[model samples]
Target chain A: MNPLPRIPSPRNPAPLTIADLGEQGLLQRLQPFCAPGVVGDDGAVLQPSPGQALVVTTDTLVEGVHFSATTTPPEAVGWRSAAANLSDLAAMGALPLGLTVALALPSTCSVAWLEGLYQGLAQCVGDYGTAIVGGDLCRAPHLVVSITALGEVPPPLVLKRNAAQVGDAIVVTGYHGASRAGLELLLDPDRALTGLCPPSPQQRDQWIRAHQYPRPRLDWVPWLRSALAQGQSASASRSFAAMDSSDGLADAVLQLCRASGVGAHLVQADLPLPPGLASWQGLATALDWTLYGGEDFELVLCLPETVLAGLEAASGAGVPAFGLRRVGTIVAGSQVTLHGSDPQEPGRVLSLDRGFQHFSELF
Target chain B: MNPLPRIPSPRNPAPLTIADLGEQGLLQRLQPFCAPGVVGDDGAVLQPSPGQALVVTTDTLVEGVHFSATTTPPEAVGWRSAAANLSDLAAMGALPLGLTVALALPSTCSVAWLEGLYQGLAQCVGDYGTAIVGGDLCRAPHLVVSITALGEVPPPLVLKRNAAQVGDAIVVTGYHGASRAGLELLLDPDRALTGLCPPSPQQRDQWIRAHQYPRPRLDWVPWLRSALAQGQSASASRSFAAMDSSDGLADAVLQLCRASGVGAHLVQADLPLPPGLASWQGLATALDWTLYGGEDFELVLCLPETVLAGLEAASGAGVPAFGLRRVGTIVAGSQVTLHGSDPQEPGRVLSLDRGFQHFSELF
Candidate 1:
């Protein structure tokens, strides 16, 4: 068998190894992101906010299975792990506070690589004011990093999975399919000229960075929470069912419906597709990517029809800024339907094979 | 090359895969150890006590590096992982409340095996009053389980590694070396008849169980807290430094000394050995294990001479009735010495070829 290929060191003045990185390296990377009350050592400490509850979530990334060793950088892996957990916190409209990371690395792994990974993780945490508090170190057959994040939600602001109602109008944040486009670029580099993948170095960098460090929608939490709390009517306040979309819009919408025990109707014309993909063929491909691609980390929300006014009021103030657009609505049935043109001629809802199945395809 | 040996299924029932066990089965198994507020879908929710702080810790166990697939059962691996983290909590005199588990399994791994592992983990959690809160599941090259446990301690009751003072007496809870002896038995099963190993089936079972599922000394937390609250002199309360002896007594003493900036003098004759291992050769072997073997999971505590009465008053009534012994005294310098009859003549301190190293060794 061929010997394992060595990972290249970052182009810098000095290189470091796993031992050299140590606890200090981790602390340096995470310290900037930590909130005032969260401290490091045992775990990130979150002082209880008087009227809020703490929301915690965890996600793990394994080498090879999650991403090929040759294709994905350690820094991207670190960033993604933090982003994934933060996404969960954002889904609950919670303020990200701190995180603990447990890392398992092969003995031969260099310290420099680990340090770079921390750099990426630190960048994300710092961006969101989340501290890297505590974690474990161990040897393993392959590289694995598990991160648990803690966030706080004011009692009145907590969004749960089971809060959607039959008449709720569904809205989503941000554009979709960019990460999926980036994935296609990585998997088939030759597909660049087709406009499916960007060709220039700058474009490549943008795509790669998007794949590696997609931001969590934490900034939108306050606006969403405020709108939900107004509570004049479902439409008067901003309250509705909300969750982050990680495993693509299709799966996320399906999950929301399942939790609410209702069905949904998707308006194809309302989707926010990325630039330059306009023709039906192009749109269909992009839609496929948008529907089932993973790691978008945006929010898919269900708002009561009464709260539509509150959502519109928030949008008018440029609060959500990108603005929430209606993509679907909850109905009385148990299946997600896609609407084309005429109400009498509803189009067949296109279903892609499962999105990202972590351990098994069963889910 | 020969194919890897298949994991053995128990004789009485066909092995169940993780899918077969589902969420409820795994939760049911883990429910016993967790307090009412511990488990939740988002993550375990722990309520911090008044004037108390939360202590969080995480550790991961991999299939081959942490345990041998053939020799160690999956259940033991799961149980020990929880035990190890809880031990850290106990060292701080904290009560464990909840834990989140992230599991990475190869696609071919059986669901039943995962169920058994959860059963073991759940048993330990139930025993500790820790709830299973939340976790991530993913596919990987080998089995990997990462657990994060949350614990609480009154601020005044928190014991730290840096509190040992010169002239403080060193105390240890429970007997040492049994785990090392059991490990020796596992490595060389044919040595069962030797006095170095357990002599009977019952003794052997006990030894193995102790190694596999050692209980964290959480019962001592309340007693330690009470001792702290009684306003004993600084020479008594402030002098106490505590940490778990996970990496054998000598190493633990070395770490405690490093943390406290002091040395210690151990009485070789006072080193407690497991019962029935008193013969000259057996005692020597047991002593070696006690000094250098890993995974004892007992507490090594340092306190002033004045608190001996308080400790004695609390023992057996709350603390485990087993071997709590005075083994050494803290000194002003930075050396750890083993003392014999001649206090003036320095005793020879034993050294091992290597200390316990994780992951890197395998690679």
Candidate 2:
């Protein structure tokens, strides 16, 4: 018997490749995944919320650069693309309204693969309480999935990188290095991160999923707002800052420092690696991945000490799975200094910044 | 002695290629071209005008697919990309607001070329009364410029493809096919257009400029709206439709017909080619380009007869630079029939639709 198509593209049952369906047919298939009555127009029409400012962000994912077609499923690629833009919106404390996705694909790409991508994109967008409003499709050598998400935030509540204040505490949502570990595992199962024992199958799957389809921390916006408000009540004057940790923790901290003209001192004791890595000897390998392995899609926020207490009080002191952790403090300099991070020397201080420059390095 | 890098990257100062400057450095260079105080954050914040609907659109132009890097200058590529999206906004009767551009470039791309691209992008965006509010940069095998534009139009005045009505006159803004002729001339100067003598130097330059830097007809929105409203006053009940002619006049007519469930009949005697093309024997070559050569970036609109008269009366019966030519009329059937368009036979009829499918063929 003949083998069936590998990827599930049940929606585009008739057309085998994108060229076979043509632009109209492709648009017809895509329309249902977008907001109702928003497609089939020159442009989508959206009404901004009363007394709200629009937050706009866009990000692109390329075939070989962002995701390896060999290892990553098409659906995961789509989810990751949308999530990157959504994470930016979340970092700015904005509620996502809609997005416009533009895809440039090679002509020979399978219809089923594109269908899976849209399914993933639609799922991620819908789960975030929004929908794809409009998009464009064109031909190119590599598959470039570019997404622009529009969100809304009240003017007084806008979170910004320049808002970080001296004496503020720096915290991050979710565990770092898990995504980096997951990616290395996916790229080469036999040779994972150095000194990392091959994890259990369940652990491997979870890590890989974290890397492939990292969730945006939009959920933390409300909790952060509430916590910040409570903190403001305790101290009348302060500046709270936040940004997404898409380009590694080191870069995020450095950017926040550069933008706000302040320094960060990371406390290694507060940083946690994913569970099941306990058999490892030292924290050397985990530290590198946590500090420099990018695409974490977590939130690195700076708030006053009062807010950190508010978060613990709001939760049950454990601060449940917003992954609340006080990793550092905002200081008076413009560099990110790590304390007790180097296992070779106790209380070792290593200054690090500018992690993973796109063109200068091989990622 | 080194030809000054062949392109002027004065702002980039010392960076030779995109890889040299990296993401942060490149963004720093690009910041001045965008809206003030919008960059260096997770996202851009825009405040929309009250009581207006947002018109959003996104489009992409790939290196080999949209333009040739060797022949098409970097600046034109940028201008063309912005113009494409801006045309869609104007098609919906929306005022230009701002745009977010996401570029995926090869590591070898020159900083000078990118700087020139931004210059053209900023010029076009600024000329249309807007700015580049946000953008993204990433590595790819080829160059891809994807832009998402946001405009605003009052809900009552929105133009749509499905608003065409029977007995409405179909008119177009500016000339068509000059861009096509220009592209042909640029791609091969000596071999110009088929079955025609070579164009004069001035004419060739004009045609080439049309193709390379096709202007979005945002200037026509006020004129058309006023004309439509005047017609509405005369009739009180009619549907006026519009869309950009990016996919050729035939495709625009077909889309409008398909969306509105109507048909169109073109009157060929009305279309006038460039002054120099009159040296040709018949209308065959010009007609082919007019009917099918895409990327004109003009506006194809449907208006009542009263609106046609209003435009003529308002503009001293000439309609001047608006290029107001009523070349067709909407009908009850579902096919776009060209009347007397076939040069081989007098009064011959030809039905045409679905002009270009990107993935299936060379553009």
Candidate 3:
């Protein structure tokens, strides 16, 4: 039998990795941040809330596809990974109950990086009043984080895509494209902003932060529910359909319309571009990016026109804080049309840019 | 901008890949297999069972790590992945409610392969009386499947790892070592059986089937509860602790002991070897593999001494079917010891093999 030569890694002496800690040690590191008494069990036991239904959403983020390992901070990657799932639950008007993070790590991944990643996941989950209840760890060629977030909402308020009425007002909770721009800057920090009407350094930094740490719209849910409830009569049932624009605004709009069997008329002039975008539209194409770029983690909602009057008057809570902007209306046709600034002219059918195709595309 | 020359393939214009389908087309493919009315929404809504606590567990299986892309069939891969997580819920004595499957696929993955994978996943999930409630798909350099299984159990019967008493009898449902031996054959089908005292062809086939299609002990759960209840009077409380042997029997025993804060005395003669393992113990080291080799997917349980007499008499349903074997007894201490066939000899401390460390090793 021939024995292979052993080559010890001595030159650079890289940082301590998860491999060095082993499963038990790595679990020990995680137990403190995860939900108390949840990590040691066969599975996390969550008591069901009476009269409420449970909502579950899952999302996966791969190392190179979702965030560049070398360029992006580990904690920010963790934050964004968790935010993606939490945003889905928030879109359904469910408050988070807990989360289970399943990670597949590479041998080269450092323990410090893992710690920072968990810290980010825990912080985002904790910020929304939930804990990391359970998780599984294993090996892979690259880093992969799959988070399944469990949330709860009353059965009546459990939002669905098909609930939008024909006379619904299309709304957005916040600005868009900042996350895409942030991603561009992060990928090529010194270069991606060279086009006409580049964002200021401060604006670029904000965009970077938006991309790195986009918060889920969980805080806006309670306020919206309360605000909408106030406007309706005692016996009238009320509902507003919503979906997160993680796959860009156009994609979300198209999905909502398709699911609801309705059409949407998006007004160009009323587009809620990130601050200062209206002034700088020529060479930058920021408006195009704003409408098409994804990962904003903002909710695109549809409120019934009848309740719109009441909701507008019932505001002050979630209204000013999240900057809910009325973008368009749900029309009768099935096509999503974009109307120009001129009121007399007919609208053009919006072309669909395929968003985030698995196996072929990346963010 | 110079466009790269399009090199068209003339020979072997391969089958339809997931890239050709895109994300929307892929969702359309998955919609039917997933839970009815659960897909096409921001998140899945599950009506919580009355008076039942929810149990959640997650597990991941990566290509080349958990399953071989070339050797293992895609459907088998899917079945094994779901089984891994389902086993966790089964160990906790919970009835599955639903599951969320998040997959990260490579460009090379074919749509046919994906359909088969989902079919396998759906079959296993459906067999256990649940559906794939939600899922997310994205691009990755390799095939990755992360499944989060949700379950429900009455609060009192929420089997946890910490409920074992000092005098509890350690029991295992079904056999062990077959999964490891099966893996051995699958990895090197031609040469793995060359060692001393290899099994018959039928036995080999059985072992391989065990590896590819191991079922979760969900069927045994109901019987377990009823059996334990039969011994206790109307007033006395009854419960047992359990954990899956996915990380091998020894690892499961060690973990159950560590989590419950009790030591165990494993009888060497009483170890539940898979059908032909005890006979093939010399060069093949089947007993060693039985104890240390992981991915068995059987449940290791701890039943109170008082209930043992009743449970033994309370058989006929899950007993003969799954071959429930009593292998050890829980003792007061922190160390897990293995006693020799000669009961007079003092037992020796069992050395830990550090089962299934991520990023460092693979089966």
Candidate 4:
């Protein structure tokens, strides 16, 4: 072997790419935010709690398709990417353990951009009591961030989409369609920070924040599990079903219906609309947004009436219960009906309503 | 709600994109190969074995960078992506539980291409006694497959890179440089089925196959762990360390050395070179490939001399022991010295040589 020349190392101020950081250097920079067991190794070791099952989920975000570099900041992109996968865990009523992110970056990307991304990721993980354990870094023509999040749930209380029972009350936590409205505001061509919008600055900020920095609603998981357990004792609901309203309320409900081999009768008046919907010109537009808008990251559940009563009682006692509205009921059929008035009448079929379909409009 | 007009659906023969399949449709297509516990819900639930800790690792593959569409088939891409992460588990002596893949595909991508990719992935997972548990699909301008694999290992026996001690013998499983040679053969512009190569067809095929379908050497993990335990009892060896040589022999050795805060004295002649290299022109070129080429997916272990003895005895007894070759020893210095002959003479410093720096010459 011949002696190789040692190359001069690039300083922080120099034009930098991931290549300059190398795999080890990048790992070193990320070490501070990692959990105790996530040493710089091939895999992160985790000890699952006793009688708990591991829950794993992944989500991918592409540069042009998922977010526009011109509009979305690097930090928000990282934040939302983690948020998406964590929301999956929330739907399962799992306690998040940690996350792993695999990022492919363009060679022209700067070191500052990567640092900002990690900063945002760390913020989200820390806020949720989770850590970013380990990940792979590669070069590509564009940016892609793929996140895999791990969580733990008690085996008996594991929530699934195919567990809904007929006659179950369908409920949702939080308002619907806010994220879609926020997405529209962010993508609007004529919207300066303060121009071409009827909403106040606070309302505008709320919408944009909801779109870019959506929180995974994991806080209500314990409450939901307790309610379900009590329901199983008092009622013959037999099963529990829950999922995230990521692809709009109508689509998520339809998905739950499809998986559970059941149908639903949703009352239009019972659906929770965003408070800012009053600022819009027409109720139809607000309804459309609530029905077909995506990325809300809220939980939709099918519970027995007994469970709903227990939750309402908890709320009466000021136990900070999740504010769930009874929007529908699981029925013995194959189609989901969205009813405006009389239940005896043939209502509008919502099963065919599409939400945010990727590769349809963007790509 | 008003009745919405039903849109005409595109037929199978029509131009179909991922949007037409929809997320649920794509998942249904993939559901056949999933494990028993992997319910089509928000996340895949896994039960860890008793006394076992979970190990998680992730890798990302990007089109036009990690693999070329013109040169590599979609199945090979999927197979190799899973192989890379599984190899990380092999390094840690862990049993693979399952894998989660997050894919971003272009709108123009064909359904046939996706089927081929999953076919390859399913075959690999089945061969390893693991399963495809869950995944997410989205749209992108280019192809990106990010896989996160989970494994299980007893906490006490978990292998790590930072456990090497002074006087530890360095050994590697399988021949080095085959994958690099195979990669070169695949990338060669002039190689028509039998054109311009000095090696036999069998040898050429070996090189290409090694590159495209490298397997994680997990069969020998139990043997290595047992050997280490015996060595500790019989010879009082202080530590043991191992890592996958995914980044070539020289760089992997340097990485282990760095993590253990030790250096190495490696004998150039003692390194294991692939048998196919004899069909090449010069020994120096073969040595360079063995030393600096990456992505071999072979294990490199820093073990006590006593453990190597135990492993050799097992090999003699007809047990499936890895083909181990003693190449070097851990030393109490900061620089790795690759010596040709005389130890006192000037030797090449291997630490300065970089291997497979992504974006160095490509972009």
Best by DockQ: 2
For candidate 3, what is the DockQ-based docking class?
medium
TM-score, ranked from best to worst: 3, 4, 2, 1
lDDT of 2 by residue, A68-170 (tens): 8767888888888889999999999898989999999987888878888888898889889999999999999999999999999877668899989888889
* Candidate 3 clash pair list: none
lDDT of 4 at B91: 91
User: How does the DockQ of candidate 4 come out?
Assistant: 0.54
Candidate 1 chain A, poorest ten consecutive residues by summed lDDT: A1-10
Q: Clashing residue pairs, candidate 4?
A: none
- Deviation in angstroms for B150 in model 1? 0.9
Evaluate fnat for each of the predicted models and list the values in order: 0.41, 0.87, 0.80, 0.76
**Candidate 4 chain B weakest lDDT stretch, 10 residues:** B1-10
Best-to-worst order by DockQ is 2, 3, 4, 1
Output the worst ten-in-a-row residue range by lDDT, candidate 4 chain A: A1-10
Question: How accurate locally is residue A119 in candidate 3, as Cα lDDT from 0 to 100?
Answer: 79
> For every candidate, how close is chain A to the native chain A in TM-score?
0.84, 0.89, 0.89, 0.89
Q: Flag regions of model 4 displaced more than 4 Å.
A: A1-16, A36-39, A189-197, A235-237, A312-322, A360-363, B1-20, B36-39, B189-197, B232-239, B314-322, B359-363
Deviation from native of the Cα of residue A111 in model 2, angstroms: 0.4
Q: What is the lDDT of residue B155 in candidate 3?
A: 81
In the range A207-305, model 3's lDDT, one tens digit per residue, is 778898898988777866665665344427756688999988988888889888999999987777777554444524666767788999998888876
* Superposed model 1: Cα runs more than 4 Å off: A1-46, A195-206, A232-240, A278-281, A306-321, A347-353, A360-363, B1-47, B195-198, B231-240, B278-281, B349-353, B359-363
**Interface Cα RMSD for all candidates?**
3.7, 1.2, 1.9, 1.7
Q: What does candidate 2 score on TM?
A: 0.91
Q: Provide the clashing-pair count of each candidate structure.
A: 25, 0, 0, 0
Clashing residue pairs in candidate 2 are: none
